[model samples]
Structures are given as structure tokens and as C-alpha cells.
Target: MSPVAVILTALPVEYDAVRPYLTAPEEITLSDGTRLERGPLEGTPWTVALAELGEGALTTAILAKQIINELAPEALLFVGVAGGLKDDLQLGDVVVATKVYAVQGGKLTPEGHQERPESWHGSHRLVQAARSALRELRPDVRGHRKPIACGDVVLTDPDSDFAARLKRSYNDAHAIEMEGSGVAHAAHLSRQLDALVIRGISDFADPGKSAADSSGSQELAAGQAAKVAIAVLRKHQPAPEETPGPIYTGDHIDFSGGTFHGPVIGKQSRP
Candidate 1:
């Protein structure tokens, strides 16, 4: 089988975690067929692009589409760090997104769509496969293997109200993060066929904690997340059975009375 294409912003810690599993590609090419001249992980098929912090969903989506056009990879994985929405999660706890929710677009009312932030989609089987693989290898790595919370807008804020809103909006989500929704949106738009967005909570997102204070913490969490994502890709082949699951339907979600109010309400979210 051909190699599954993976894309991510080269956050140092995450690069280190999955470095061991990556097979360093032989040549390099950009979406436009222009050769990438320089990068830490250059000259390899498993390429890394520099998407500095806060590089919103639209930018991320463009990059993903580029990869799809150039690489045409079977699968795409977005591995990164996220703020822990749940209290049980500490620094380094991994939360695999059972679904990616983009809350940027308009509200999805049954009657019609209301104005909201722009949003996108993600892969659950990839989440499950990654969790399964991680458990198989490092049982110590805690896997909050459930539907994860995601959005196109930045969920990072230094307030409890934001956390409360996240909790209220995405009741089924175990954690919240910034990049998953954007990357997931790119994959969905480009028709990548199969895509995955996996994140780890580096910080608990305590209203009291400063984002800088938790830099080291988030990196460690991202490292763990990268490990699980790579393991999932390695062990699970892209078979028809392997890829079976629901279509992604969300971008910043809201669960009211145990009902999903995003793009697609998943079974896991219902009960």
C-alpha cells in the first residue's frame, strides 16, 4: 500500500515523539510541485510545514488541500496539543477526538443555518485506531478515548466562562483544542478520502494557569499524542473494515438534552 500522507505544524515536542516511527521519505515535493528547499524534516515524504501558533483554520485548510493535490496520500493525520476541558485530565493526558467539531460557522438550526464561525470535519475511526494502538504499546499513556471536542476558532482563553461555555456546548467532548477543527476541515474539503485529527491535553486549561506556564506541559502531552497516532497508522491497515464509521459532522458543537447540535450527531454523543 502507498504511504498515508500526514501534515502538521512542526511543534518540536510532537516532531520528536513521532520521529521514531516515521520512515523518512526519499524525495520531497510541494502541492504545487515546487521542491521544498529547507526544513528540519526535509527531503522526506512525511513532510512538516511551519504553521506558527494561531495560524487559523483557513490557512491550515489551504495547506491540507495542497498536500492532497501534491501527495494524494491515503490518509491525513493532524497531531497537536490541546487545553483539557475536563478536570480529570492532567498534563500529558491524551484525548483522541472521536469527532472534530468546528464552532466557527453559523448555528445549525433545523429550520435553517444561523450565522456563526466557519468550521470543518474529522475522523473517528482514526481516533479509535490510535487509542487502541497506544493502549497496546504504552498502557501507561492514558487514552481519553471518546468523542473529542474541536472547533475552527481558537478555544484558548484565560477565563472560566470560556471553559464553562465549552462544557455547555460540547457536552460529549472530553477536551478542547485549537487546531483539530481546522485540519479536519482541510481534509474534508480536499476530499482526502480518509483523515484523522488527534490531540493531547498539555495543560488542564485552569482559568488560573497562564498558557506560557504550561508550554512544557503541553509539549509532553503532544509527544504522547503523536506516539498513539503513529501507532494507529502502523497497526491498522486502510482496509474497508478498518475505515468503517460515521461521517464527520461538526465545527464548534452544542449538545442540548443529550442531542448533538453540530454537523453530524454521533452515536457516542447520543447515549
Candidate 2:
């Protein structure tokens, strides 16, 4: 059997679009009050654990920990719509984050704000799968493999101080959203997981947010992002390990655990 993937979203609207893509979907409520829609992808080799965790990285990080601990997914993909930050990225464009920046990290000094940012790059193998998935993207849909900024704030103005600050710090960010960093961090600590953030551009993150949102871009972008996600899954091939797949080895095959330093130090097989 193939491994499972947990797809996370922040809003109901985002969940609505992702839910339909799930096959044999059924709601499962955990003892901790965390709800999940578990199922499989029809043509893909991955089982799906889909959840809508309301909002914020804090909410998302806590829930992510619980879900991964219970489900033990092979990979975790945070899928949803984001406010496009780069000029070339337009509405409905899909961005697969090469790196996720937790943009809110910094310390205010007497002179100026000190840069103390935290960032996580996408899982190497998953990112390779995403790259292959790009070739299969719908012609109408444009996919960008780039960095994205994730924070708790919903940025509405491109000219806002926060926006300008982002440009100065994480200048390579292609889109802005509220969740990915949390999920990434959770996946980080749980060293045995592959993780990535996928977003569709719903708005320009400018003064035109209300206008673009009112025109149904959110739904369109969400759908497109979901499309790219399915594509990524289609391209993904899981390892057939009975235990947590080889992580410490040089192969890095399906590794899902906390930070790996040296090779397997004292771990031994049943002698």
C-alpha cells in the first residue's frame, strides 16, 4: 500500500474546493477535537488526510502535530490560495514554495528591527515531484516554483509597512499566506516527514483585494491550486517500507522524523 498525505487548509471556502478532489472521503473526529476527512486519490498512490484548521500558524502547528502523530503521513502539503506578491504572478497562478519564510520573526531594537527570520525549504524529493508535476499543468494554469512568505497577518495592501518590510527582508517571496510556516515547522520537528506549501494566487495583495475576491478569484485559484496538488501526487511515488522509511541513510528515502544530524548512531535491528 502507498503512504498517506495530509492536505491542510485554513478557510471553509478553501476546504470546500479541496474536499471534492478526495475520493471515498469520510469525516473522522479525533479524541482531541481535531476533525479530518480521510480518503484516497483515485489515480494516485497516496491516501489523503484532509483538514481545515480554521486559521493562523499557531492553530495550524498544534493541529498538524496531532494529525501527523496519529496519521503518520508520508508527506504533508499545505494547500490553499494566497495573495500574490510578485508582479508577474497574477490571479489563478499557482506557486509551489521552494522556501517558506515565517515573515513575522524579528526583534525591535533601539536603532532598528533586527533581522532574525526563520525559514524552511520544501522537502527535496517532494519538490522534485512538484517540478515534474509542472509539465502536466493545465495550459491555462501558470505554475511558479518560488519562495513564499507565511505569517499571521492578512496583508491587504501592497504599500503597507508590512509589505514594504517583506520586500526588504524576504525579497524573493512570490506570494503571501497565513499558514504554511506553521505546518513546515511542525514537519520540521517531526523529522520523518516530507512537506511543501502550494498556493494559488487569489488576489494581488494590493488595494484590489476586495475587488478580486468579489469576482470569484478565490474559488478559481483554490481550484487551480488543488489541481497542481493532485498533479504533484500523481508524480509522487512512495517507498514500501513497513516502518518509517529510510531517513538517516544517505538515500533519504521517505524520511519522516526530527532533525537528522549524523548517520544512524546507535540504532540497531532486532538481533
Candidate 3:
């Protein structure tokens, strides 16, 4: 069997972008009625299982765990579009998360909010593979390896309370999204699987976000993110399966009634 990988998206547009890269996909319905598509990724030694689990951190965490348990993929990737937080990140640019922060984990107090930040780092091997893949991509498809902030709400106003909180706490995050941290946490609990979050900048997390979405930036960003994901798969080499050795029940061989034609070497015992 080919090595398996899971690519999860949070929206239909993101799933549509990735679906085209799968060859001869077959629908798989889980016992819980969750649907997924399984097929070989074009020009790679990977069999990809794809799912779109909708939005929100909690929902993503639940469905991601379900998929991981069902497929047992070598790696899991959450690929989709995100709102750019940095000035350098332009629309359609890709961001491969080196670390994902659950930005909403904090406590409100009289002295103000106290941050209890939680984060998960991306797999080092996967990050290296993405770096290599980015070099071969189109010049217009800019890529960055940076930290991402994940929360429950969709950020539209840069001056919103959540946005201000993000700036004060997760200042290093380059992109804001709704699901990466959930999937990252699920993979972390699995212990044996490597996972990464890749997103494309659809809009700046500002009042202009609606205009950007109206101009189809979301679809373009989704496609760009999916392209980077496929490229990473092409550059990555899965670990080879181990071959089982023959089982030996005893330390010594017993040839009790064998007729030997040649000189047989054995320990002679006195009858």
C-alpha cells in the first residue's frame, strides 16, 4: 500500500482546490457518517485522504481526531485560506505555519487579561520539505514559514477586541485563522503522526476583508495554499515499510528422521 497522508480543509472552496490534484478519488463514509475522499496524489508516492470539516476550533478538533483514527496517515495537513496579519503578506501568498497558537486561551481578571498561551510546533521534517518546495513554485507564489494564530471568531476589524488581544499576546503570528490550532492539537495527542498547517492570505484581517472575499481572493488563496501542499508532498519521502523476518521457535534445529546423502554434522549422543 502507498503511504497515506490526510489533507483537511475548513471550507468547500479549499476542498475544491485540493480535489483536482487527486487522481481517481473514491468516497469513503465512516461509521459515524463522516465522508472523505481517498485517492493517489498525482506524481507522488502518497495516497491522500481528503476531508472538509467546516469551521471553528472545537469542530475541527473533533473531526480531525476522527479522521486520524480512521485513516492512520503518516502525516496530517490542515490547508486553507487565512487573513493576513502582517503587512508583508499579500493576497494569494502562502504561509506554512512553523507554530500554531491557540490565541483564545487566556483568563480575564480585574487587573486585565492574563495570557495562558498554548502552541504546537510543526514537524521539522515537514517544514524543511516545504522550504524546498517553495523554491520551485511560481515567482508570484510567495511563501513564508511563520507562526499562526487560531481562534473561534472570524477577524474582520483590526481594532476589534479579539484583534487587539491577538496583537498584544500573539504578536509573532503572521496569519489569523479558525482551525489550525485544533488540528495541530489533535495530531500532537496522536504522538506518532507529523502534522503541519498551511494557509494562503485571502485578506488582511481588517474592514476590507469583505471586499477581498467579494473579489474572489478566497478562491485564489485556497488554490495557492493547495498548490503548496501538493508540492510539499512531492518533495517529502515517506519512511520505508519494514520487512518482517522469519520466525524461529527454537534455537536448535531437530532433524529426527531425515535421510542424509552428504556428511551430516551433528552432536553425537550416547544411547
Candidate 4:
């Protein structure tokens, strides 16, 4: 009886990528001064919402909670693009976040990026279901592929030492983005909703990665990522009475290092 909640950055390019399989959202404004335009996908009982971007985890959580108050979706999903952190990952790869990690100061010694020990819960079955759906939807693009990686990292100049620190965090971390961490935080704050963040690799964090082929690559990856995320949400039909646990609480929410201004439209990073 309740609706499904999905948060996507309010950009037309990103929206166009996922629009093929999803229905348009009905316009609604929340009490917290956030506006949402939402709709459901065709053939599936999935609902979507387009929320404003540029907020960090705290702001994202606040707005997400407001949306939840109104929509009461059984599951929450955040769909958008990310910057690939590894050389092996080219533009257009999709990443389904299994866990969310935060950065406190800058980069972590030895471990690369220091995760603030704060994490938002994600479902493995949901990520797997999305991956399986990708296999079914785009068999050609993903024939026998390796696992895609997802997580949050601070974005910095490609040539700067900051990026190098992020690179050292994980060998397989494919992408970086602004809102994934906040989105995760928001879903975790819901206290009664299942949440997932599915990101498409749009650009390599390295400056050398060409932008010539990235647009098309990102578009294709965005479609695949949206389709996969939608499938994951649809596959798990929770009982109407099911309620989420304490994972939604903000007890673990942390944003200590503060903010930085990177490339706004071209690259992804926290706000």
C-alpha cells in the first residue's frame, strides 16, 4: 500500500539515462523544504523520486527523512553516476554499493582513504539481484565480467595528492560520488525502510582518461545501472507489515573533515 522511494540527482543527463524503463514521478514538496517529483517503473511496482542535490550526508539524511515521512516507501534506492577511481575501470561501468564509507580529514595512511568507521547498511541479495538483472538486460556489455566496486571517497583534483590517497584505499574501488554517502545515511535514518545505492561509473578519477568516449559510455552504463537497481528493488517483495531495524538511526552518522569544492558538473564528490 505504501510507495517506493528512490533518490536521484536532479540532473537531466542522469535522468535521461534511467528514464527509458522508469515512469515519471508525481510532483510533491516536503515539509523540510525539499521538492520531489516521483513515478513508478513500468511492469514493476517500483516508485522513484528525484531529489535536489549538493547536500552532504547530514543534509541528505534530513531531506530523505522528510521524503520518507510523506512517501513511506518500503525500500529506498539512490541512482546516479560516479567517478571511477581505478585505471582498470573505464567509463560506463556500474557499481552497486555493498557498503558506504566516509572520509574524515583527507587521506588515510597505509589504508589510503580513512573511512570514519561509519557505514550505511546495504543488502547483498539486492546488489546480487541487480547484477543478475544486468546480466539479463545487457548480455553483450557484461558477458563474463568482474565484480564492480562501490563506496564513498572525497573527490579532488585529478593530479593532486588527494586522488592518490583515494586510489590507495582500495585496489578495486571503481567510482567516487557526491551523494552516495548522504543517500546511504538518509536511508539508514529511515529506521523502517530498506535502502540501496546503485552508481554508474561515468569518469575515471585520473586526468588522463579521455572525455571523448565517456559521454556515450556513461549513458549506457547509467541505463544498465538504473535497470539493475530497479530490478533489485522489485525482486524483493517485502511483506506489508515488515519493518526495518536500527540501521536507519543516525547514531553512526559522521562528517568530520568538512567540505571541499572540486569540479562541479564534470566530476563527483561530497558536498
**Highest lDDT: which candidate?**
3
Which scores better on lDDT, 3 or 4? 3
Instruction: List pairs with backbone clashes in candidate 3.
Output: none
Model 3 TM-score, 2 decimals: 0.90
* Cα RMSD, model 3: 7.5
Report the lDDT tens digits of candidate 4 across residue range 1-271. 5456565653455666665555655777777667767777666656666665543555666667777777777777777666666566545566777776654434457855554445555755566666676666674443212322333344536767656645555444456666666667777666756777777766665553356234475566666666666666666665445343322222332378655444323322322
Candidate 1 global TM-score: 0.68
- Cα deviation at 218, candidate 4, in Å, is 4.2
Q: How high is the CA lDDT of each candidate model?
A: 0.60, 0.88, 0.91, 0.60
For residues 1-271, could you state the per-residue lDDT of candidate 1 as single tens digits?
A: 3344464643566655655554443345674653322122323233333222234556666666776676566667777777677767777778766677665455668865454533344565565567678778665688776556655444556365545656656666777666667677767776536677677776655554466444577568777877767666665455332333465665453455354535543333222
- By TM-score, who's the top model here? 3
Clash totals for all models, in order?
A: 16, 7, 0, 6
Clash pairs for candidate 2: 190-257, 191-256, 191-257, 191-258, 192-256, 192-257, 193-256
Residue 69 C-alpha lDDT in model 2? 91
Give candidate 4's error at residue 21 in angstroms. Answer: 3.3
Query: On a 0 to 100 scale, what is the lDDT of residue 21 in model 4?
Result: 56
lDDT of 2 by residue, 172-253 (tens): 9999999999999999999869999999999988888999999999999999888888888888877655443334554333
Scored against the true structure, residue 224 in model 3 reaches a CA lDDT of 98
TM-score of each: 0.68, 0.87, 0.90, 0.70
User: In candidate 1, how many Å is residue 66 off?
Assistant: 0.8
The segments of candidate 2 whose C-alpha lies over 4 angstroms from its true place after superposition are 243-271
Arrange candidates, best TM-score first: 3, 2, 4, 1
